[model samples]
Target chain A: MKSIKILERLLAAIPIMIGVAILVFLFVRLTPGDPVDLMMGSAGSVSQQEIQALQEEFDLDKPLHVQLYIFLKDVVRGDLGDSFTQREPVTDIIGRALPATIELAFGAAFFAVLFAIPIGVYSAVKQNSITDRLSMAFSFLGISMPAFWFGIILIIVFGVKLGWLPISGRLDYGFNFPSVTGLYLIDTVLARDWPALKNAVLHLILPSIALGMQLLAVLARVTRSSMLEVLRQDYVTLARAKGLREFIVIVKHALRNALIPTITVLGIQIGVLLGGNMIIETVFAWPGLGRLAVDSIFSRDFPLIQGVVMIYAFTYVIANLVVDVLYTYINPKITL
Target chain B: MLEIKNLAMAFETERGLVRAVNKVDLSVAEGEVMGIVGESGCGKSVTLLNILGLVPHPGKVLSGEIMFQGEDLLKKSKKEMRDIRGKDIAMIFQDPMTTLNPVFRIGEQIRESMRIHGLFKDVKGGFFKSARKHAEKDRAVELMEEVGIPSPETRYHNFPHEFSGGMQQRALIAIGLSCKPKLLLADEPTTALDVTIQAQILALMQKINQEHGAGIILVTHDLGVAAEFCHKIAVMYAGRIVEQGRTEQVMDNPHHPYTQGLLRSIPKMSSKKDRIEPIPGGVPDLAELKEECAFYPRCAKAHDKCLSQEVPMFDAGEGHTVRCYLYG
Candidate 1:
């Protein structure tokens, strides 16, 4: 039964990767730049002679399919090619950036779930009260205001005005924690450096908040509405009629049923996290794949752009697979 | 051993007040099965719910008290009510589909209240004594045995859905008997079963009465079923009991016009009761029936006195009471 579900989930992941490849391929072609312009420049300063030589050398002079085939071939061989601007391999740049982005995602997810579920549960349980109304109001505000604006407001208030912490950047000037693993939290803890750990967490705070606030609202509201519906099921009344305490009735009986719908909604919200990386990565100047993709798009760097989009697609497909497995865990009906 | 005094109930809905149960005074002797028989909307179920404290919210028991073993139930707090609810008084509800939790096994659901009320008293100091735990399981197994379940020991792990209708009722009976409650409020308990199962269940109830000596308040819409099972029968119409008497007396000498209609409606085996006339017209809405006996509109014997006010109970015979102007 478990294996069949896993097989379905594995099958479901294929389409997203196909979508990512298709989108990157078409969009890369749609944007007006070849490897010639990327290798040289748009201005007459580079001269036509140099641009022609560069295009031929990089196999950009070939047909679209051939160029695509060559790119795919190199990609399979772990060749991300060189970044003309950075004067380094695009692979190295993304490899360095991916860890920081992963750390932020984890930190944001932890805080959002921790804050949202309890608030949602409490609001649902205490419904129509001041706490419920206030929590709802906050959710609206979180979802409405743009992440960049929220990020800016957080920086102005906590960073510039109070002079408590740095406004941007991931770490202090000279503090070097050895990157045993790429995540800041793990490395900071390993180096036995409390202050770097503190600053790293602090730096992630505003951007993660800006990125995660919308999801928190979405998750909490979905949870509250779902719980309110589940509360009316006959099983819940039966549990109450069983002479169980109110806490047990709400927690054990109502919440478990409520979580099934909430899991589907949470999965969608987490999937939307990739969109946040676009705005958040640029705002904080955090070195991550989102910034790399944005930068690559502007330069029309095919290899780098394809790789970055693939990561987002890969993470998203895997998140959905995890959600399916999670649904099975919460409700046994979904199994084979 | 049970006396229900002047029970009144009203449901506060978005519309005005809807009277559900009203000023019902009833008594049940030790081991006697008293049935409140009525058509739907006659408040038969609500009166039993008022006795069991299972009436849904927004439907309030507006006045009166229920005295069980000479102690009034309305005075007890919700916590104290819990102590009496499933322990001292257990109920087998009408819909077998919903009475048991779908998620839990039959044995666990049945054993829950027993372990709550009976066995835990010995292990109250935050520690489980081996003998107390042993006794809890022993008593639960005995209850399943008493209910005549096939292979009670092996069937302990099965869920409610796994049981057939008759088996489910037996499981419910097992749960009801687990705490050895003083009163069993069975609201149409066998109404959902087939004829054969109904007979078996009725027989089981009689066996339970013989063995345990607990007062059983059986509610059913079927007059014949009531006559067969109950020691005393109360004929309710439009939220009031129009006639009540010992089963033999009520069956043989029904006085109220509505009772006469109901008795005649039953296709009886008795020779004199051959010409069956189905009761004409439906039960009048209790909430809309203003300033008169609720059943008067349909009562063939209703007069000017019936229109003026509600009829009070009049003694007709030995332990017989009929609420009608003709009887008065």
Candidate 2:
């Protein structure tokens, strides 16, 4: 039964992916700049015939309907075409940058969950205390501050001023570690190079914090409110009446019910973390998909932009699917 | 088994401090079923919560001595109180629908208290932890069967929502009886249930009392239920016990005007009276209560002297007491 439900959900995503494809295809075309003109404009003066030839070569000369048809056809056949500027297959470029983005996104999520839950639960349990007030104030500050601005502040304080961490790139220069999975941290661990692993972790700390600040703040507030509400539930009272320790009452009885809403927020925030990391990636000079996307947009690389967006849409669908599946496990009353 | 002396609890409300339970004193011997009868807002539930020290925030025990097995529960630390709760004195709440956690299976919740108090820790020593777990499950199933639930083995895996309201109450009672507590405090355990189910739950409680020999303090507004199930009855009015005695003594030969009014309010089968007589007024606001009789405004037999001084418990008959100026 569960498998059938999951399969149905996966089948329903097809139309959504197709809709994204059509929208992205038309939206990229509607933009002011033409990829052919931009590519040739930088090469000094060129003839109209030469421009027409380049346009035809890239299939930009076709009518909008015909172009959409061809694009959809190629997408179905697993072909994303070549970037107009980089002149490489869009899939190959995405493959190279995909690992870095996945690494950063998961790192930020890890940091957020590690700190947010405890902070949220503590604030709720000790509501209105000094620590609770202070943590809430900090979370408020985190939410109000922009990710890029936080990233710059972190760079200034931790990178330029104290020289405590690296400011740019995945690792310091001349650190040779075999790329097993393309994620520097995992690769370092796989190679069992402790110094490289340490350096990789140091590089990750600042960007992950900056990228995850808003998510952590939002998650903490959601967890706090959810927990506060669940603590008033009769089951929690019953648990306490059953002589369970306060810790067990809060964690075993209350936290699981509270996590239902928190998990929903987490699912939505992960999509935001992936899409909104563009500016943070640029600020931190991290070699990830967000930076690649920014570069592709500036050069009017339609295939590259389209490819990146499709991946993002696919990720969102999968994230929501995982959340729906998680509901069944967390609450028996909820079916797939 | 349990004794309460001068126990008072106050809540900080928007208007002012409301003493929810005031100077309430009662006692119950082992295996005895004591019923605290009162209307809504008369502090019956608060008095029960006070016994377990489980009152919600903004309300606190003002002054009290809850002696259980010769030790004042009020003097126990929070940890000590926790140790005593569920292990020595377990409590069941009103709404069975909301009392059990929805996410967990029935048997797991029943096993939780045993797990908390480490009930069977010495059976096979620490090494056979899995063996101890098996024993706990077996005991939980035994409890489920004892509570009159059908097919205990299969029902153990079901969640609270899967069970009917009566079955949920049974599961809750199973949890209450898991550790075999010496005293059970039930606050309107059958108010949310239908008449037949109410009778069934009360029968189950009576059985638990008879078999386990655990004292029970039941809070209810239905005098019929109290008369049917309890050995002694304490009638509360505005946070004070107005009359208390043997159930037959209080029900048949009630002394206080409030007790007489309560009895008259119950609809009878043989009496040709068209309508039952309801007490004239609602319970007085507990916050504004003065030293005079709280039932004075509602009592049909009120006199001037009843308002002149505070009324205290006066001996009405053998092992019976009534709080009234007339009795004084």
Candidate 3:
């Protein structure tokens, strides 16, 4: 029964996927830019014939319907087309960058969950205390601060002034770490390069913290409110009256029930974190899909833009689906 | 055995300090069933929660001594209270639907109290922890069966929501009795259930009270339930016990006007009349309470003197007490 529901959800996603493809295709094409002029290196200096030849060669000369037909056909064949500027398949470029983005997303989410839950639970348990007030103030600051501004501040403080860590890039030059997962930290560990791993982590800290700040704030607030509400429940009162330890009453009885809504917020935060990675990646000079999208937009790389949009939409859909599945596990009463 | 003396619990509300429970004294001997009967906001439930030390935030136990089995529970630390709570005293809430944790299975919840009090270690001498777990599971099933739950093994694994209201109350009772507590405080356990389910749950509770020899404090507004189930009945009015006596005496000859009103409100099966007599006025606001009789405004037989001076508990008859100026 559960598998059938999962299948139904997957089937429901097809129309959304198609809609994203058409929207991305039209949006990239309708934007005020020309890939032919970009490829010429000097706009209007190149002969009209050169531009025409480049357009014809890249099939940009085709009509909208014909182009969409060809794009959809290629998409059906598991092909996302090639990057116009790099002259390589968009899939291959994305595969290399995808690992970095995944690592950042997971790392930021891990950090947020690690600190947010404890802080939230503590704040709720000690509600109206000075600690609760202070932590809530910090959460407000985190929520209100933009990732771009936060990232820059981190860089200026830790990189420029303190000179404790690298200002940009995934790792230092001349490190020969094996590329196992394409994520530098993992690759360094795989190759047993301790210094490279340390360098990779040091680089990850600022961007991850900046990227996770909003998510952390949201998670903490949700967890706090959820816990406070759950703690008021009769079950929690009964658990306490049952003579269970305070820790068990709060954690086992209260937290487990409280976590359901927090998990939903987490899934949404994952998608938002991925979106924030665009600015974060650009700020850190990190090679990820969001940065690639930014670069593609500048150069009018239609295929790359469309591919990145499609992937982002796909990940968002999957994240929500995964959260729904997790909801069933956390609360068995939830059928879907 | 449980004894409470001068227990005054108050809540600081926006209006003012509302003394929810006022100078309440109660005692229940071992293996006895005592019922606290009152209308809503009369502090019946609050008195029970204060005994369990489960009063919610903004509420304080002003001055009280809850002596249970020779020790003062009020003087004990929170940690000590926790130790006494499930092992020695357990409480069942009013709403069965919301009382049990929805995320956990019935069997697990039933076993939780035992696990918390380390009943397995006491029974098994701390050997074969895995086997002890299985034994506990077996005991949980046994408890489910004991509470009259059908197909105990199968129903034990079900979540709280999967069970009906009556079944959920049974599961709650099962959990309450898991550790063999010497005292059980049930606060309107059947209020949320239908008439038939209410009867079943009451019967189940009565069975547990008899079989386990747990001193049960049943809090309810229904005088019929109190008369049927409890050995003694204490009628509360605005946080004070207006009248208390053995169940038969209280039922036969209610002394205080409030207790008399409560008995009159119960729908008699033999009566051909369609409408039952409800007490005239609502319970007085705890915030506006004064030293005079709280039931003065609502008492059908209130005299001028009843509104002027404080009414204290007066010995009316053999083993019966009534808090009224008329009793003097």
**TM-scores of the models, in the order given:** 0.83, 0.96, 0.96
> Docking quality tier of candidate 2?
high
Model 3: per-residue lDDT, tens digit, B61-108? 999799999999889999899988878999898999998999999889
Question: Cα miss at A86, model 3 (Å)?
Answer: 0.4
Q: How good is chain A of candidate 1, measured by TM-score?
A: 0.90
Of all native A–B interface contacts, model 3 reproduces a fraction of: 0.87
lDDT of 1 by residue, A200-271 (tens): 988888777878888788778988998887776655654554456668778877887787877887777676
Candidate 1 residue lDDT tens string, B1-328: 7898888888887777778887788998888899999898889988877876767667898899899888898887777777787777877777676666655677777777776666455653325566666566677778888888898877777767778889888888888787787788888988899999999988999899888998899999888789898999988877777788999889889888888888778775766754778877787866675646877667776678887876799999797998888877
Model 1: interface root-mean-square deviation in Å? 3.0
Q: How big is the positional error of residue A39 in model 2, measured in Å on the Cα after superposition? A: 0.5
| Ten residues in sequence with the least summed lDDT for candidate 3 chain A | A36-45
In the predicted model 1, the residue pairs found to clash are none
Fill in the DockQ of model 3: 0.85
lDDT of 2 by residue, B133-205 (tens): 8899999999999999999999999999999999999999999998889999999999999999999999999
lDDT of 2 by residue, A165-282 (tens): 8988788887897877898888999899999999888888889999998889999999999999999899999998998888989999999999999999999888877776899889
Backbone clash count, each prediction separately: 0, 0, 0
Task: Flag regions of model 1 displaced more than 4 Å.
Answer: A1-4, A11-23, A35-39, A52-59, A70-112, A115-151, A156-209, A274-277, A284-289, B52-54, B99-111, B118-177, B190-214, B250-253, B262-291
- How would you encode candidate 3's per-residue C-alpha lDDT over A1-336 as one tens digit per residue? 999999999999988998999889988899996887777886678888988888887789999999999998888787999998999998998898888888888879988999999999999999989999999999999999988999899999999999987868777888886687898877888888998889889878887887898889989999999999999999999999988878988989999999998999999989877765899998989888889989998999999998998989988998999899999989979988
Instruction: For candidate 2, give the lDDT.
Output: 0.91
Off by over 4 Å in 2: A42-44, B125-128
